[model samples]
Target chain A: MSFKPDHEIYRRRFSRNLGVGLCLVAFVMLGFFLTVEKVTRGNPLDALQGKPYVAAPVAP
Target chain B: MTDIQAQATPAEPGFGDFVQLLKPRVMSLVVFTALVGLMVAPVHLYPVAGFSAILFIALGAGASGALNMWWDADIDAVMRRTRNRPVPSGRIQPCEALGLGVALSGISVVMLALATNLMAAGLLAFTIFFYAVVYSMWLKRLTPQNIVIGGAAGAFPPMIGWVAATGSMSLEACLMFALIFMWTPPHFWALALFMKEDYSNAGVPMLTVTHGRRATRVHVLVYTLLLVPFAMALGWMSIGGPVYIAAAAVLNVWFVVGAVRIWRRDEVQAEADKYAVEKAFFRFSLVYLFAHFSALLVEAVLRAQVYGV
Candidate 1:
């Protein structure tokens, strides 16, 4: 089967961009958590004010 | 027609071309605002489901982006700012973008429904349609009010987030949507003010192009005034706290002042200044939304710690 020149070019570009994007995503995720730990004194979630933990009222 | 026949385009499609297809800049706003919506709502979902729902929301936003790119490739090619986007640059075919958009839209909406609720999924689907079809294909060329009405599509993410958690909408959630909706006109029109030539060249009916810069400036000032009260009301609703109220008050005062400055400036001064006032307001608008939402998060935290709302 003859390969179209444009198809090969598109495939190469797509793969390259996908690889770059994946690397950036990993870096951001890792950097974000690391920054959170360093800034929040090692309890990253602690820095976030979580939703209130309200228990259901008992039926009378 | 002549350009299409020349050498069949020899420039090698690069990695950046494909990345441009996703419209990363617009996607960031959707993700941030949606996350804020999810966080501030007075409801909860299981951690895994919540994560999945948000992921699907992001995909839906991406779908909208792809479709917008496919449809607007013609105008995008003409506009200097958009000329190098994936579709126009020949890195990706328009049909491929359309296929990706349709596939992602279906996946996102279905997954959201299963993970969250039907209502949230419905809203997400409508948002994608509104942006891709209503705004991009329909209103963009027909009316100067394009951004004003189309801004609703961008505004829906937060409300969808709130609905994802609560399975319904509330005054607080709607206000967040309204705040962004009203803010979009001035924010975009400001860019339009500076980039009027780009819109005119592309045959887009931006306010600055269709109605003239002076009229556009007045509209910016009017909308900025409207945004202030809506932003403050979020604070009053207990959706925010002292931090948010203070931030909104100060930001809004400065914002209005900026808009008024742009409005009152003489055309000669405005032309020389160009994007200065508008640019400041635009940059500040980014901080304004972030600060308001950050305040909400802070208020939520404080309430959790002290009053336990």
Candidate 2:
């Protein structure tokens, strides 16, 4: 019901880990976007307008 | 009846508690491998779809983690390493974790299927099941080989990522999976070696507890040795390059050396050192896997530029 001292410590560690994870996610996203932009040679936002919306093909 | 009724009264879950349920440290490894898999696969999805697929896979990983936290709450409460987990810490109720896990598992699988291919979605579903059921409920308590076998669940992300891109598993993907799978035992065993007392105290059937530290150390060395070829093989695959090969060679050797140090240490020395070997091995093992995968990623980028992959 209430947080203990160990709980506080875990929370701190969790927060720090979460920050690291978010930084990684950001780094990956930036890299992905930059790669996409480089490959397309066009603005990614502009490309999004014509983006195909195909449904997932069923597994065989 | 009275104690059962008391225990059945569910506690409320706050926002932070929900986040804690995900086992975010484990999720980071899953996310990294899955990202690499999607990145280097020959087939490409729209960037938007690719990110979405990875996100869903991450959610699926989190869901499985939540389920594991729920199922293992009892044991986790007893174990020093896990006692602070959300469910065990009373920050969240077990049933709530179960419900959240189920909901997110369905959402992730279905969303991943929609965002990418059914193959990736299917793999996500299976990973969740393997972790929640096979590893957590069955293997963990049943066998000393728990992490040895259970480690497979953690090893599937890259393969799933590759499938998300290519719509099928490939030789390269299998090699990537093998690298992680082989690395798991030693990585985990190193932790177990230091935490043998904790495992014994908690009554968990860890290899260190059941077979003794000498045996566990030997197994750790063996698995670390096995990981060398698998890591190197990834460098030989089409996805690999010279840089990757060089990196894997060095990292694997370093890893094996760490394992060997742990194996050769006498109990008196090990006790005098007090977690030194275990700590170094555990920390370096993390660096080792990251180096291998990062090298692969670097190779993929270099090849894409030089040879158009």
Which portions of model 1 miss their true places by more than 4 Å? Answer: A1-60, B1-18
Clashing pairs in 1: none
**lDDT of each residue in A2-58, candidate 1, tens digit only:** 865666666776777787689569646744654454455444455577633344598
Off by over 4 Å in 2: A1-60, B1-12
DockQ of all candidate complexes: 0.12, 0.07
Error of 2 at B8 (Å): 16
Write model 2 residue lDDT over B1-309, tens digit each, in one string.
455434453444445678789888888999999999988888887766777778888889999999999998999999888898888888677898999899999988987887678988999899999999999999999899999888888999999999998998789998888889998999989988887777888788998888888899899988888888888888778899899988887887788889889989867888898979889999999999888889888988998898876
Candidate 2 chain B minimal-lDDT segment of 10 residues: B4-13
Displacement of residue B175 (Cα, Å) in model 1 is 0.4
- Candidate 1, position B16, lDDT: 58
Q: What is the C-alpha interface RMSD of model 2?
A: 6.5
Best by lDDT: 2
Candidate that would win on TM-score: 2
TM-score of 2: 0.83
